[model samples]
Target: MIAKIMGVLNVTPDSFSDGGQHFDIADAIQKAQCLIDQGADIIDIGGESTRPDAKPVSFKDELVRVIPVIKTLAETTDVPISIDTSKPEVMLQAVESGASMINDVCALRVNGALETASELGVDVCLMHMQGVPKNMQLSPVYDEVIEDIKHFFAGRIEACISAGISESKLILDPGFGFGKTYEHNLEILRCFDEFKSFGLPLLAGMSRKTMIGQMLGDRDVSTRVTGSVAGAIIAVQNGADIVRVHDVEETKDGLMVLGSVS
Candidate 1:
């Protein structure tokens, strides 16, 4: 499969690495330009932190954080802009502002999220998370992890289809570490190819996540870039169609040398 490189633009004060870093619109725009110059195929922008144990923000606060950046990125970048949110209102406003994609970690379960996506007919990414960000990893379990994830995706796909969204407009993310132990994350990583059965693009966003931190015993997110690239490469080699990353230039360089990837 042809791999899509989704550059991440975290516009939150609490996102794991870029927390409070790109909260400003100017910084966010510059970063988006840099990502585009680095060969990012899409820019996935997130307003919420979604970090485990993180406090939830209000709708106005989230809207304040994301809308400007999405508006600017949509206008400036040739690459498609994806608003990474579960809020239906945010999705609507983002699309109106020129976003071409919706990357919802909650799989559009939030009331009206699916409807907004279907109504807009924009590209949507449906992800698998066991629970909300604040407490997801508190104690996540599964009869079988991969099966459980695939099942979740299956149900989400059905919901999207029922809402009149076509299969080609959807992409699936296994939600690594969103509500998983490092072991659970590794299990998904080890057998990532199994997700190919879904017959859609598979997006693996492991950049600076807890899985790599746990594996290397490094809690610092900045240092995890290499580890993230390694995971992305492995996932792509296995069956991933997209690698959502924070480090655009590095990931682009690494993927090019993989030789087998196209």
Candidate 2:
């Protein structure tokens, strides 16, 4: 029955979707407010583009792109802000700037990231990505996708706990498109409840992803709103506590309808 929505606000020029749309600080702020008005429970701000083949941005550049927006939103709205990054430095700065959650694609595998999150004392989402964004889609392989990611999450959770982070502060994301083929993504959705065995919150972010496109007639990113909402609905029904999404209003409406029925 959980239908928390974490609206994506990517402030990069090449984020695969709505990238350049929010590169300007004012525009990003406006978009954040729009997401908030649309019923986003959390505004997830990403500075760098993690899309496949995305060129890497310097740490300083990444910080510049996200910190101002986080600071502005923190001052203007009380909504929980999530910083989506893999770097330890960005995590620290984002928290200091008022981000309550760290949505890391690398699952804190980077050096010092676990310790940093522990020190910051914020909620952390550990996502399962097979490889880096640059080459993640290049022949990704897995003997059992769900089992593989479950093991990865277990190890990362252990690492976080070892680093003095409380277990209550952890969330898990299956990473629908980070490094998976169409079949792999579907399998994760089908077996999402198995991940809840850890008794932690589960976040599913299949919004406007290639998997949805591939499943729905190769629709373009902008034309995938219905598919994204469908995926979000399926994720929520399959034991997801949170649905990271772009079409917040549509997803919210869908969840409302679902709530009345079930």
Candidate 3:
């Protein structure tokens, strides 16, 4: 099993979770080191906000927000850094600045993003998100979530392969809450095993999301730790290769127990 933990390292001051906490360079570096010590196999650094109905950040703003942080983290840790961006320029700059992976929400459809990641020789994770960030959850509709996302992944993977991206340098993520309704999210989560048809490592990122909040009806994000770990465990049991999470210590402990009992 490709068991691994991806720590959320947000450089944005407005992220849905842990925002503004790491906006300071010193704080971000400390948090990065702390996460590494806490057992994060990978550190995913993102500068932009992809929360529901979020506004877009400019390229210059994103670069300024992320480059220094990426450089700092890269120099300070041996863990691989994945740039969570959809912009081609951002990917190019991020990879050049030390990001070893491209964890795009848009799956490289933003013009030159595909070409850039293909040339960078780093890992790329193609994800399935319905619609754009600004309006994805605006009464989104799907005839069938599983089949639709599978099609999206197939097309994106084919495009990446055709664009000269290596086969071994790719991963897949079924973006859980990006554009899904409460029922849609749960359905996708429960039927996650159906995604195995794609034949690629799956990444699960359902930590502290709206779906969980809506599931429990009245839990705050901070208090959603149990729900998040439960979702992560379900994802693992369903065939996830990696899980991107925020509650690193709890998630690690949960996985250890799950492994032991298995």
Candidate 4:
């Protein structure tokens, strides 16, 4: 099957790539609609930045940032909505406000998150981050990156199952840049298909990330589109079921060419 495209909609003022650009509710809605028009299969709305060394926003603030956009988008579009948050309260309210999926960088490890996700009964994308955003990139070490991530996924899958969440309702993300050095990110993409052993959908989100920038000789975020699209295509060719990206149109174009040839 062709890989699905998940458009990123960050409503925070400090998101790495497109912050402040969509902080206004009106702009956020406009951007969401634009992504839908650009062939996005899902819209992943995030309030918190989650960029390295980023400060956390309170759940109250997060709700205020995302709920209205979620509500409006739910009412306006048929595309699925995914809330990018780990707060149980935000998850609960966002679902009530019409979010159908939870994309948690914390992978439901936050207190009450597993229980809340189970109760909500929505699709959850459990991402592997070596550490919290504030300090994750300071220095990330893994005995063996792929094996270590697999181990983490195993434990989290068990935790979700124990919390009454169905195995089918889960998706996995290797967390491309969350806590990885350039080499780790490359290895993950090179051996991405290994993750498919879990029998769950895999998401690859490396759009305009530091790794892409680094590979392109320290290109600025705005100049990383080509590299980001290349990464998305590689991930899709390997095993990515969904690619979370800021440049939805470009990624979709690349995937179309890939689908036609492959």
Clash totals in order: 1, 0, 0, 0
Runs with alpha carbons beyond 4 Å of true place in candidate 3: none
**Candidate 1 weakest ten by summed lDDT:** 253-262
RMSD of each: 1.5, 0.8, 1.2, 0.6
Q: Encode model 3's per-residue lDDT on 47-96: one tens digit a residue.
A: 89899878899989889888898898888778999899999889999989
Q: Candidate 1: which pairs clash?
A: 13-20
Encode model 2's per-residue lDDT on 84-189: one tens digit a residue: 9999999999999999999999999989898899999999999999989999999899998988998999999999999999999999998988889999998999
Which scores higher on lDDT, 1 or 2?
2
- Model 3: lDDT to the true structure: 0.88
Tally clashing residue pairs in candidate 1.
1
TM, every model:
0.96, 0.99, 0.97, 0.99
Model 4: per-residue Cα lDDT over 104-168, one tens digit each: 99999999999999999999999999989999999999999999999999999999999999999
The reply for model 1, stretches above 4 Å from the true place, is 260-262
Models ranked on lDDT:
4, 2, 1, 3
Candidate 2 residue pairs in backbone clash: none
**CA shift at 170, candidate 1, in angstroms?**
0.8
